[model samples]
Target chain A: MIELRNNELIFQFPKVHTQAVCRIDFQRTLRIPDDNQEYPLPPGLGSFPINHVDDFTDNLPATWKEHGGVFIPMYQAEALWMNFSGHYPCAIKIAAGKINAVSGTQWTKKLSNRPQDYVVVPDQPWLDGFNVSKGCVRQFVAMPLGEGYTAEEQLTGDAEHGGIQIIVYPMKHDVYVKYMEQHRVFNIGDEQCLTYAPADEMGLGAGGVMRQEIYEDDYGIDSWDQTSGLRCFVHLTNSAIYQKITGHPPLHKPPTAQEYTDSGLPWFDYYADKKALQGSASLSQLTSVAAKKIQKGEGTLDNNENVHPNTIKTIKKGRVVRDGRF
Target chain B: MTFSSYIRQSREGLKAQDRRFSVRQVAQRIGVEPAYLSKIERGDVAPPSEGKIRALAEELNEDPDVLLAMAGKVSSDLLAIIRKRPKLFAELIRDLKSMPDHAILRIARDVRDGDW
Candidate 1:
């Protein structure tokens, strides 16, 4: 079952399909200053308000309703992360404007093993941005399309679609049962929700690299039941357009990196057991959001100063015993 | 519950009771893919044929007739008996619908042993 409740997507699976469950939230976070230095993971401030575009067909741009999915409001240059809570195992494919976020290839309906274009969840708790390197990701920051900031624009040279896109396929029932018993891997699920973007829509651009890992699927590619998949499209609108169209005041604007740092909240680090999947060649080549902003003659962004990099609390996974005096 | 769900429960119960009655084991015994059997359990597909249901009944140690009934199928043997005298059998079966089991048993005993 898939439901949109309280601005988050909750997916539940039956006992037989236990590995097909997950919850997804689009988390608003600080736009890290992209000064070519990797940064620590930022905190999730809140969820961007999301609703079905069909609910406001009359008021919305016909293209949005025609695309037929959901919408969330975003500010230009604001950063966001996909928070995935898994209860079982699942495979998720995410794309921004039809560009594969993992492999940087054009989107395909099927999951491929050649470049491993999808993320295996439960091992991967959350995705902060595009997979641009091993043990790090370029944070996902929103930008106006056609300005050459988005990966889609840089790679494809077309600004046709602007929003994030996602699709998730569940593990086969028998494979899930077999793997759970054999490897005794943790049970959890993660699926992707897509976003459709027209010209005026906001696009996700690569931002500062943060310490986040996307795990390679330990189970073979066939573990996922390609026959059955869940897909959702999420659209992006500016806060002004969001309120004028939806009639709800926009979500409280996200705090800038400077403000968040001054507030004294610590960034985080998630330590996992396995080696993360290495970044793909194409993804590593895209320009950072801050660099693009400067290239476009916008002075270094406001409130984007780097935070004290040392102040991060490490959240360890499993029994990651530290070396102590023994 | 559907025949699919009921059989699924039976299989699951068997797993709990004995060694294991995984979808693969039961489906393989019944000559179907585990995936197909899984879908059947979820009611995504229609119940299997009478022969397969009987095979499933054998593997799960259930009564073939009962399983067939749940699958909305009459055993071929029952179909043959009904086919012998379609109109009369239809009337007889319909007439016996609400009768007490003892009454039907007596009628059955008379027809089988006492007289033609």
Candidate 2:
């Protein structure tokens, strides 16, 4: 018997010519922090919350809960958000469980080889109203590319400097297997070819709005390999929704190169203090007119700027140190 | 060696090989006209002036010195900028190259407007 629970498809298959039963489950959805809440985020990090799990899991394996059940986590939730919202940088975590230690071990071993820590089945369920698979379970350890930055670094305000920080939640082996099992038996009716509409065209129904065309990617899961895991569709709406969900403000207008330079934030200076150390160029040459304006009390820098007395002190100290080094 | 044999070997050495890039693609990357760049690549025209080469390097995301070397030209000012801030130099070049002509025009317009 097989069952669909919380977007994961669980099934019991008998060992060849044996009475023993093997159970398998797949993860389909993830959870992320609510938009209104201001949770701690890594610098330049953005995420959107996805609430539609059943829409994705309408075609479930038969009696999925009978064998066992699976549920989505915050990380998987973020993936769904990226898929529908078109956010480039995103991430999610997955958790699965099994009825017996033997089944759990076998499932874990099979899932261990999967790249990006695709499988992370929990030993026990954290929430009620969920059925745990006795013999087999699996979870996901998914995140968008470049999402592993430390909290301190995230808070340091350097996110915009790097190429748009893109995070992709690659489809995993278990997800493919689960999709095959359910799609193989189900009659999808008119939904056979899941048509995605542009986000603007999606109707606001009981299921909220179903954004379309947001998940378009040049490559599909079929093309995924060791190197291909970094690839995923970057949706534009995902950024808006992520800002909405994470309570982070959006970039109201595109920033110019001069604007970035004028921000006076610390940048990745490849030359370090080469010119300054050489004493060939004055600070006036390196500093933007905006910095000079701020120094002269003619204008104020943006909130992102850290023009503290200590910051100046550190620069002076660096100048002294570099002078000593020379 | 015989004069004829030496001449044959020297001619072979002087003959340039086709390096895979089309003139148009290189011109597009460097933000120049295909016809002009073609002439330069074929040595039918002399290398660009120093200021033009610096701008071309910024547009193509190439080290000014490398571009100059390829064209058999060099300038001390471009070399100084490269030496002072190699990463910034690279970034500025990339940014300039990646920006569209219209975007550059718009930025120029905005700068002009702000100046007024």
Candidate 3:
């Protein structure tokens, strides 16, 4: 369950027997001491302002409405970490667009104010790309709801798979409730409480299509009143999310950085801050307030079959297949 | 070359291309301290994580995997594959080590052609 209060988005999995099972604070920074030292995660910058895409239906594509999410923004290089202060352990997966970022336990299921896990952003931007120093990740950055970038366009693909998506893989609800009941934390049927089925039975079948999308506004001035363009979001992809999304065969251990470096290949960083990012303009002049018309092409599907099979009529008179088809 | 020397050479190559990319600027872009980055270049500290290595590679326009390999690290893709089928990979590697280039090529061709 997600609760937005006081500029902090709290992700609570009360019934899940997962680490960070209590309340996982999103955008809320907390100071916690761990085994080695203290990681005083800073508070998220400003309030979480969301512009619902439904309100701007006329200006967006038809698919925009189906993808129910609000536009959220993040500044370049800013870091946000999830802090857990709950009793149960829950695993959460954070993704930017569809790309897996980093997923792991936010903290151990210790019934204390200790942090089980945390992540710093854009440093490991996407699964395929890392150390992106410049702009938001390719997966997360979307053009305006109506504007989609072409598949071939690398750097700034205008329209894109938008939003910051987060999904939680909680432990079985019965197991969690039984454990909690034994521990005397029996607030089961409270208001707006949720009970999750066993992980495999949760309809997240093989594909693991469980995700929450947070959209972005690509045009006009943003809440900061700066020209709205490409913005970044913090995405976390942990082991559970990794397994669900990629379907990678289970292994005994995660890979160490040293193991990664031993394999000779080219690792690329594609952050916008490291590139020549165009500075956003404030409304210094009255003319800047005028709605700008960005020239955009229609959203084209990335597919090979252009003509529908239903549309083709078999004509016996001139039965000829073109383009060297046998 | 040692990871330290590799870093030094890569850093030098970056500077050689653009003098404006100071250690501080490069380090800040990659989210590391100038002192720490300097230590890395001079071989005073051990090689950094794959993420940091990637950041450095992007800044230097150098191949990140090469740097990572020098530092004895594996890429995320390979790591996932290794995790997925450890025994199969080990057996394949063992067999391939003794196979001639032409035999390996034939196997690769068969796999590509969906005959294996």
TM-score of each: 0.68, 0.17, 0.26
The digit string of per-residue lDDT tens for model 2 on A99-184 reads 11111111121122222222111111111100112111111112221232211112232211111111113233343235423556
Better of 1 and 2 by lDDT: 1
Best by lDDT: 1
Which structure is stronger by DockQ: 2 or 3?
Answer: 3
Note the Cα lDDT for every prediction shown.
0.76, 0.25, 0.34
| TM-score top scorer | 1
lDDT of 1 by residue, A192-240 (tens): 3455453257888999888888888898898877765556667777776
TM-score, predicted candidate 2 vs. hidden true structure: 0.17
Provide interface RMSD per model, one decimal: 30.6, 28.0, 22.1
| lDDT tens digits, residue span B17-82, model 3 | 787578888889999999999999888888998999988888888798888898889989778777
Candidate 1 runs further than 4 Å off: A12-19, A181-193, A196-199, A318-326, B1-116
Winner by TM-score between candidate 2 and candidate 1: 1
C-alpha DockQ of every model:
0.01, 0.00, 0.01
Query: Model 3: how many Å of interface RMSD?
Result: 22.1
